[model samples]
Target: MRGLDDHTYRKRTAALKAKRHDCWLCGDPIDYTLPWKHKMAFTADHIQPRSKGGHIYGEIRAAHRSCNSSRSNRVTTVTTAPKTALRW
Candidate 1:
């Protein structure tokens, strides 16, 4: 996988955090103050998976560290199931 260097990663994270974007994966707020290893910590995720031949400097979106790691190079689509009510 094409991983980012420490400087690039931190730079990207800071930029995203400054924008106050929600995690594109799980739609949760990123805790930029948290340590890098924290589950809620901010991370930059590739718009396309690197394992699928995505470019190293391609578009990226903000994500939580755990959410990004859980994706694990798989293509993901986040959707919440619609709520249904029973009719008597």
Candidate 2:
């Protein structure tokens, strides 16, 4: 995102928001009208992190500001434990 100009950045962010997608990280609704600094505000997140050599214009997804900040630049993967019945 370093070389991306303000216009392009705005355009990209707008496009992402226009998709009306849920937060990719937290799976929650995004409040498009919220202020930029607000935790639940809409944000454009790179599917692959920029700090991890992801392209500036690479695949982008909608996310809440808080979710995006919490993810940082780490690789994302899903881990689920084997299903088992539990007795109370």
Q: Largest lDDT belongs to which candidate?
A: 2
Error of 1 at 19 (Å): 0.8
List the pairs of residues colliding in candidate 1.
none
- Candidate 2 per-residue C-alpha lDDT over 12-64 given as tens digits, one digit per residue, 9 for 90 to 100: 87877888887777776788889999999988988889899987777888889
How do the residues 1-88 of candidate 1 rate in per-residue lDDT, one tens digit apiece?
A: 2345656766765786789777888776677789988988888898788889876666788889898999989877658742235654
TM-score of 2: 0.77
Model 2, residue 74: distance off in Å is 0.9
C-alpha lDDT (0 to 100) for residue 67 of candidate 1 = 89
lDDT of 2: 0.80
